[model samples]
Target: MPDPTQPRKDTRGNILFFFGVLILLLLAYHLAKELEILYVSALFAVVLMPVLHRITSWSIRGYHPSRAIAIVLLLLAAALGLILFFTIGLPPVLNDLRGFMTDLPGRIPGAVDRLKHIPLADKLGVETIASRAENTAAALGSYIFTSLPDWLTHVFDILTTIFLCIYFMLEGEHAYEFFLSLFRPPARQRLDATLRKAELKMSKWLLGQGLLMLTLGVCSLTAFGILHVRYFVLLGVLMGLFNIIPVAGGVITIAMAAGVAAIDSWQKMFGVLIFYLIYVNLENAILTPRIMRSSVNLMGLTVLVALLLGTALGGIVGALVAVPTAALISVLLEEYAVQRPSQS
Candidate 1:
C-alpha cells in the first residue's frame, strides 16, 4: 500500500501549476500578433518544403543544388516577377489611376446628370447619392495619401515574414524534431506521421490553388480585354491574387469589374456579370471538382465552413491558409479523435 504520509494529492502544487498556465495564457493573448506572423511563416515553410526538396534533388549535368542555392533561385525568380510587374505591367495602371483622379472632379457633375435621367432618380435622391460618393472617394484618396507610414509599416511586416519563412525553411526540421521531443515516444511517432501526411496535403493544395488562380487570371484578362474594359490588366491581376481568398475575393473583384464596366454602358456591366456567373458555374461544376477535389480530398462543404471560420477568426491571412490548416487538423482528428468502425 502507498504511504499515507504521501497524501492523495498535492493541492498546493496543483494550484501553482494552474496559476502558471493562466499566466502563460495571458502572455499569449498579449503577443497574438507576433504569434500570428510566426504561424503564417511556419505554415508557408511547411507548404514549400517539398518544392525545395524537389529543386535540391534536380540534377543538371550531374550538378545538384544545395538547399541554400535552391532557396536563392526561388527568391530570384520571385524578385524577377516583381521587377517585371513594376517596370511593365504596373505603369499603365498607375497612369490610368493618375488620370482618373485628376479628372474625377470634372466627371462627377456629368455622372450626376446621367443619374438624373434614370426613372427613379428623384425618389432615390440620386444627386445626393452622387455627392456622397464623390465625398467618399475624396476621403478615401486622402486617407491613402495620409497613410504612407502605416503602409510602410505593413511592408516591413511583410519583409519580416519573408525572412522568417526563409529561416524556417532552413531550420524547420530541427525545430520540428524538438517539438516532437516534448511528447512521449509513442505520441511523438504518431504525431510525426500525422504531420507528414498533412504536409503532403498542404503542398498539393498550394499547387492546385496556384493553377486555379492562374486559370481565373488568364480568363479574366482575355474576356476583359475583348470587351475593352478599362484597366483590364490591373483587374486581371487583382482577380488572380485575390482568388486565393475563395468566394469573397471573387465577389469583390467581380463587383469592382462590373462597376467599372457600368461607367461606360449598362450592357458592358451585364456582360461582365454574365462572364463571372458562367465562370463560377463552370468552376464549381468542372474545374474545382477535377483539380481541388483530387488534390485536397476535401468536401465542398468542409472547405466553405473552414473558410468562413478562418475569416471570422483571423481575417484575410486566416482565409489564405485555412484549407491547408483544415487539412492538417483533419488528419490529426482522424488519428486521435475520430471513431473508427470495427472490422467484421
Candidate 2:
C-alpha cells in the first residue's frame, strides 16, 4: 500500500532537521554563560517549588496565599534570618576581629620568637617567612581592590537569577506546558513523571545538606571552645558557611583554624588538626551516606565527578547545582537509557 510518488520517508526534510539541530547546538555553546544563568534560575525554582507549595497550601480561613505571596513570604523569612544573624551572632565575632587585628603585630613577633626555640627554626628562616606572610596580605588587599568591578558584576548576576527564579515560580507552569508541547504526548508524560521524581530528590538534597552544615557548625563551636582556640566564634561560623563549597571549603576553613591555633601553641594546632581529621572521617563514613545517600542515592564516585565537572565548568554556581543536576541526569538516564533485566 506504499505510494512510490510519496516515497518511504522525507529524506530532504530529515537532513534539514538535522542541520537545524546542529545549528542550535552551536548557538547554545556560543551562549553557554547566558544559558547557564537561565538553567540555574530554573533549577532553583524547581527546587523551591515544594516549599512554595507548602506555603500556598496553608489556608487562613480558606484564603490560600497565591504563589507570588508565598514567594514574598519566603524572601521576608530569609531577610529576617540575615537581620537576626547580623544583630545577634555577628557582634561578638566583630569585636573579636577588631581585637585580633589590634594585637596581630604584637602577637606575630611573639609567635616568631617562639618558633626560634624549635630545633632548626633559625635554619628555616622564620623572619623571612613572616615577611612573606605580610607581603601576601598586602597582595590580597590589592587583589580585593582590583576585583571590585568583577564582584559588582557577580552581584548583578545574582540579582538577575533571583528575579528570574521568582518569575519562573510564578509562571513556570505555562512554560512547562509549552516545553512539553514540543514532544509527543506519550514522551511528554514520561518526561513529566521523570522530572517530578528528580524534583523530589533534589528537594531532599537541600534538607540533608542543611542538616550536615548545622551539625558541623555546632560541633566546631563546641570543640573549638573547649580547645580555647582564638576567634573560635568566627572560625565556627566560617566552617559552617564554607561547608557549602564541599572539599575545598572544609580544607580552607580547617587550615585557617589550624593557622590561628598555631599562632597560640603547637599543641592547639595539633588539636585543631586532629579534630578536623576525626570530623572529616565521621562526616564521610557516617553522615554523608545516611543523609545524602537517602536523598540523592548517588554513588561517591558520581557525586565527586559531578562536583569536579561542575566546578570546572561554572565555578561556585556550578558546584552548587552539581549534585542536583547529577540527580536529574541520573533519573533521565534510568528512564530512557539504562537497560534493565526485564528490558534485556
Give the residue spans of candidate 1 off by over 4 A. Answer: 5-13, 103-125
Per-candidate TM equals 0.90, 0.86
The C-alpha lDDT values of all candidates are 0.85, 0.87
Which candidate has the top score in lDDT? 2
Kindly list the per-residue Cα lDDT of model 1 for residues 169-197, writing each as its tens digit. Answer: 99988999999999999988989998898
lDDT against true structure, model 1: 0.85
- Tell how far residue 148 is off in model 2, in angstroms: 3.4
> What clash pairs does model 1 have?
none
Clashes of each: 0, 0
lDDT of 2 by residue, 1-344 (tens): 87775543677778889999999999999999889999999988987898999999999999999988999999999899989999999998877666655556557777788889999999998999987776665465457668989888788888889999999999999998899899999999999998889888987887778788899989998999999998999889889987876677788899999888988999999999999999999998999999988778988788789889999999988888888889999999999999999999
